[model samples]
Target: TYITFPIYSGITFNNISSYVGIQAGIAASGKRDNTITTSINGIASSENQLGNLSILLPDFGIRAGLILKLSNKLNLHAKYYQGLINIFDKETSLSDFTWRTQQFTVGIRFSIRNTNDCGTCPAWRT
Candidate 1:
């Protein structure tokens, strides 16, 4: 599991808006399941165990997305996140490759606010 903090800047034109952001994340807890399979003659067996996978504590990433304003209080959105850090522990593993993360999301957003809300409006609008 990871806890992430994202900071974004956005622009809106008509009913569409787009944003780009950077994120700082940390893994609170992690584990991996390792499966081993063996075959002897015509017989096969498998075993599974929860292994301790060492994850680098801190992570960084970039994100970009688009939001379509369906109304003042509703929107549709999609985003992509690319991990910039290799979370795998290179010191513990013999693999020569590094691991990163890529995530894609699509969702709807709902809000409870009036069109004339002062605190939530942009400075230019107020």
Candidate 2:
């Protein structure tokens, strides 16, 4: 994932400062073990037992990202998260399915401060 932050306060654009960040997400597929027929006394038997398998594991163990400031009052940022999920039960006869995806985004910053506060002071101040 990627992100940026923009600060916009008092109509002024400040120099870029730590305003860029990056992130990465990864995932992997699950494996299953199958067993073949067994050999008996120099003779191969047709009967065989299917091997077992462990639960599908996810890869969201580490989620890394960054943040950046575009201006004094504005900020831009982004991040990404991911993990594997199995959608099948062991008892089910079907193969296990894994799904993955996680992410978010943010950009632009605004200030609610009164504009007059920074501009020329009140006029006609005797």
Identify the candidate with maximal lDDT: 1
Over 27-77, each residue of candidate 1 has an lDDT whose tens digit, in order, gives 878889999999999799999999887677788999999999888788999
lDDT of candidate 2 at residue 109, scale 0 to 100: 56
Compared with the true structure, all predictions reach lDDT values of 0.86, 0.42
CA error at residue 32 for candidate 2, angstroms: 28
Clashes of 1: 0
Query: In model 1, which runs have C-alpha deviations exceeding 4 angstroms?
Result: 37-45, 115-126
lDDT of 2 by residue, 15-117 (tens): 4333222323222434555657767898986644554344333233224334455544555655444433442345555654544445455556555544335
Worst 10 residues of 2 by lDDT: 1-10
Provide the lDDT at 107 for model 1: 99
